[model samples]
Target: MFEDAFKLKIRPDGLEKAAARTYVTAVRDVLEKIHRTACGKALLQSIRFHGYVVNIIPYPGADVCGADVDGDYDAATGIVMPTVRYTPGNFAKGGSCSHLPGRGWAESILFHELVHALRDIAQGKRRVYKGVVMTGGLHRYDTFEEFIAVLCEDIYVSERGNPHRLLGDHRGIAPLDPALADSFRFFATGSQTFRFVERFCRENPGFTKMLSRVPARFNPIAAYYKDPRKAQSFSNSPAAHERDADGVWGKLFERERSPTLPTGSPANLPPPRPASTPIRRP
Candidate 1:
């Protein structure tokens, strides 16, 4: 069942066989865990529906550890092609990082990319535009995407009680206002986090404006918040802002039990560059 839901493809010149096997095993374990969980089952169903494939490749000396290859999301067929490319040079000869050994780094990258794939699946078939222009104009959207992924990674790692295994660092790129991060963290768990994010964008015009540039279907916030389960999820959680007696939203931030650990720098570090272009629909 797990094999059918996720297909792993390693480039011929990617990590060596031993390293690749280790990475593949780690990925399978993560997917298995997700498949077993309630929220994960729903996400797995969406992934299966889209026929998303996970490709592992050698990073071409770029600083990025992984990318979701937005262009590969085929709305027509509901297929999403996501990849977790690695910087082979960054790993020690045996595919271990000095900071985190064995397939740890690669596992982190895979988890980060998986979160992205899940988000794409949840959003359904919407036109996805990539590049610096779309990212620059809608900086908040990009940050929000990273925020949710990192937060999910943090939750997974926390559940395992292993701080060192946390994935992609968000300190620089996706720095959420600490208070805001805490509030949303308390509000939802697993895939339900998407609902909190969508509500967030609706409350913040800066985020709403950026989402508006994309097609309505691709606007993750608007789409996922409308899910019938969204309201129910909120009602069940004590962390829901509406249940707070304190008038300040930041008060809800206090309910977060687990805090994120520093995951270090991202691979494929691109020099911060800005561009101006309206995100387009296909």
Candidate 2:
């Protein structure tokens, strides 16, 4: 039904039709595989009903990002990604060296971006997956977004024979962490009763590094990814020491799994570089 879930627009000139068809087919197959599972089916439904046909353009940029989706989030066009650099291999100076993925890996990467597209559109909304409330856009730092995407991406990877297909930090650290694999194991056997937040937060999944990399302008984000003892005010970084635990990222960020916790779900700015900032494609 979502034959157009991702509309491929070739912005660059002189691209071959064969190249375009390959990408389109690869992405479609990924969706088909995800739809086979119960959880995947539900996720796909969430995006469809959200009034987003998710525009998927193969980004051709020099930046090392494999793919990223962050913008104003158009209802009709879904999360508009002006710079989704979906390509093979590590993006040049990737965190560490690793073998580049084959064209088949593109399908898996598309699945990764789909996680982003889902999270982006669900902002300001709430949905329950496997009894876990995906308060998609609520957090000040938007931590759960990456955790969930990486989690779901890894789950899909399991179905693909468990390759090195994680967000970034976790990529190549394979045999997928048993803790992370536990949830997918449930879904693989037709169960969705995953402890989304407990296990996910317990593992932390290099979220600090992800958030630390965010630009200073993206308020509510922290400074360093190493330790949390340092308190940086969510609103005013200068007043961090003056604030309390909530002020710093102590335990409040662990609300991802709290079904009872309330939740809510990046964007553009004006200046020399006004393009939308992606939600870390690494």
Candidate 3:
């Protein structure tokens, strides 16, 4: 299994090597914990992102920033090629993920890169693999896939509610909520497709508990909002009765999760809510 693992092209020098390795180990430990608690679908998300990082390469005598090279999702060969780079002086410097003390901070740096991986996977930039068989394929997403991804991120971040823990007192770090919302608007119609899933995961005790079961490899941010139970909708019904008003109303009331242009308030909307947001942890 290790044979197929992509060998590091640019090994870190001196202390850099040890630091990077330490970061990788720390990230691996986090993955193990997540595996024990994250949603299973998140595993699918991770499979698309694993083994594609090419890191610790020497500075190419230039100042270009890191970038995602691969394009869309592929069904065969689970690798998406992306190049992440940092000029010696222009990267995150301290805390749990820092490089100043010569400690590996790949987890902190790679956190956003992982988000790019998800974007690439959902956009069809990643190639799926089965054993040694590798075939190239692409999936241009429709609006629905985009909606689901957006809503999932919102649900994930909101539930985790550990912005400071993840953000590490950095002013430069983009707000997860706004960043997710931006992605939704850029790639999708911003439709209301996941209100049910989001609300159910937020309010239903049974579903909330299942979130811990989510696979570690998967983005906890995405899986938190994508409860599979939301897939169930009443047939040919505009005003479906919600068994648990708080737990079931969002899904039944709003078929989609996207916001509107006019932007009406929640109270003004009737059944099948025109607009809604993620479930608050409080």
Please name the candidate that would achieve the greatest lDDT relative to the true structure: 1
Per-prediction TM-score, please?
0.46, 0.45, 0.33
True-structure lDDT of candidate 2? 0.40
151-252, model 3: which lDDT tens digit per residue? 343334433433232221111222333322332221111122234334434433343345445332323323333433322232112322221232244333
For model 3 the TM-score comes to: 0.33
The 10 consecutive residues of candidate 1 with the worst lDDT sum are 273-282
lDDT of each: 0.41, 0.40, 0.31
Per-residue error (Å), model 2, residue 115? 1.1
Candidate 2 structure quality by residue, lDDT tens digits, 120-189: 5554233222223222121122345554665555545554454553432222222332322332222221
Alpha-carbon lDDT of model 3:
0.31
| Steric clash count of candidate 1 | 6
Flag clash pairs in model 1: 62-268, 63-267, 63-268, 63-269, 64-267, 64-268
Backbone clashes, each candidate: 6, 5, 30
lDDT, model 1, position 76:
67
Alpha carbon RMSD to native, model 1: 12.8
